[model samples]
Structures are given as structure tokens and as C-alpha cells.
Target: MAVSDECKIKFRELKAKRSYRFIVFKIDQQQIVVETLGGPNQSYDDFTSSLPSNECRYAVYDFEFITAENCQKSKIFFIAWSPEISKVRMKMVYASSKDSFKRELDGIQFELQATDPSEMSLDIVKGRAI
Candidate 1:
């Protein structure tokens, strides 16, 4: 999916603020793509602390896991969304595990796509969605 310039700008601003342990791009109303940066033992507080202060209609926390081959894999383990701050406060819909703070990406309204960590581009982090 193509990201707009506006979204890229928002991403860059958030990166500059060090606001997100992971970054997910809302491709559309029903789809979001994400890349995880945190370790396997990441905490919920640490996760929330990384969120951008700016409004994000929807977001998914990508949890990284090590596979049998020692490859890192990501899975959507948490979801958050806010229609409008004035109307409703942003909330976390799910958490993966009590100890792991992980949740499976299933039955979500928005399709969460997990991309390769290497796919995360500096341009996107700099607010230029390439």
C-alpha cells in the first residue's frame, strides 16, 4: 500500500520524539502494516509509552518472537484506536499475555500485516513514506 506524504510527516515527527517502540502504518480504514522493534520481553507500560501523542485512529503493537531458526518474527499482540479524543479516549483493546503482554492478531476489524524488520525504511521514519 502507498503511504501519503501527510502520514509520512506524522511518522517522522513521532520518530523525532522517540514515541513508539513499534511503528504501524494505517494503509486504510481496514488495513494496517507494522514492524516491531522491541524485544521479546517488552512490557505494556513500555509499549504505551512509545505511542505518539498525535491522534492515531488505529494502531497495532507488533510483538517480536524468535523462531526455531533464530529468525525474528512479529505478530500483532495488541490493538488501540480512538475515534476522537473528545468523544472517546484511546484504549487498548487487547494484550497478548499476562507475562508477555502479547495478543494474537485475529478477528480484528483492521487487517494487520507484519512486514520484515529489514523493510522498515529510514525514509518512513523520517516522515517520507516511500
Candidate 2:
């Protein structure tokens, strides 16, 4: 349940500098580590596609869209992706460690926990954004 120092630094870069579109994290031998990073120019589809189909992962997405008032807006979403098809042990680890891991990253506007693709749909994300 250890959070890497790099995770905090990378998250800070993303939130303060808009340096990344998304970040995918995985637990490597019990320590959470960065798995992949999507550049600032990457699309939401790219972020969604980066997630594995049957694995547990934590991610942060810098979401941008136009508000109903025709103003540009952004939100930082913290996501916990735990597919039902993934291993029970993996799910337990992620669920148990989520709060502690999240506490290390500040300025997260929203949080979403998805057990499958549909649960973490684009529409659901937008709903939270609003």
C-alpha cells in the first residue's frame, strides 16, 4: 500500500502544468507505480483505451469540455478501475488502499469507481463534471 514519490510529483505536474492528459497506475510487487502516461494532447478515448480489460488500476484524467454557458472548463477525475473479471486479490488490494493512495494527490475534483467499462462511461464522467 505504499505510494511512490514519483506518483506525487507526476500528479502535481499534471494538475499544475497540464503536462498529461491521463495517468495509469498499477501495483508492482505491492508498491504502486506508474504504468503509463498520456500526453496533454491525447484524447479521452486514448485514456480509456489505455486501461486493461481485466485488471485493477488507478488513474487520473484531466477532463476538459465546454460548459453550458459556452465557457471552457476542466476537472481532474480520480478513477478506480476494478473490473469484475479481474482477480479478487487485486480488487481487495485496490479497494483497501484507495483512500490512502488518493490522499497523497491534492486537487482532485471528482472520484469514480468502476467495476466495468459501462460503469466508467464518458457520460458518467461528464455527469460528474457538471
Give per-candidate clash totals.
7, 0
Task: Choose the strongest candidate by lDDT.
Answer: 2
Best candidate (score: TM-score): 2
Model 1 spans with C-alpha error above 4 angstroms = 1-25, 28-31, 57-77, 83-104, 107-130
- Each prediction's TM-score against the native? 0.29, 0.97
Instruction: Note the residue pairs that clash in candidate 1.
Output: 8-127, 19-50, 20-50, 77-103, 96-102, 96-103, 97-102
Per-residue lDDT of model 2, residues 1-130, tens digit only: 8888889999999999999999999999889999999999999889989999999999999999999899998999999999989999999999999999999999999999998888888999999898
Worst 10 residues of 1 by lDDT: 94-103
Clashes of 2: 0
Error at 32, model 1, angstroms: 2.4
RMSD of each: 14.2, 0.8
RMSD over all Cα atoms, model 1: 14.2
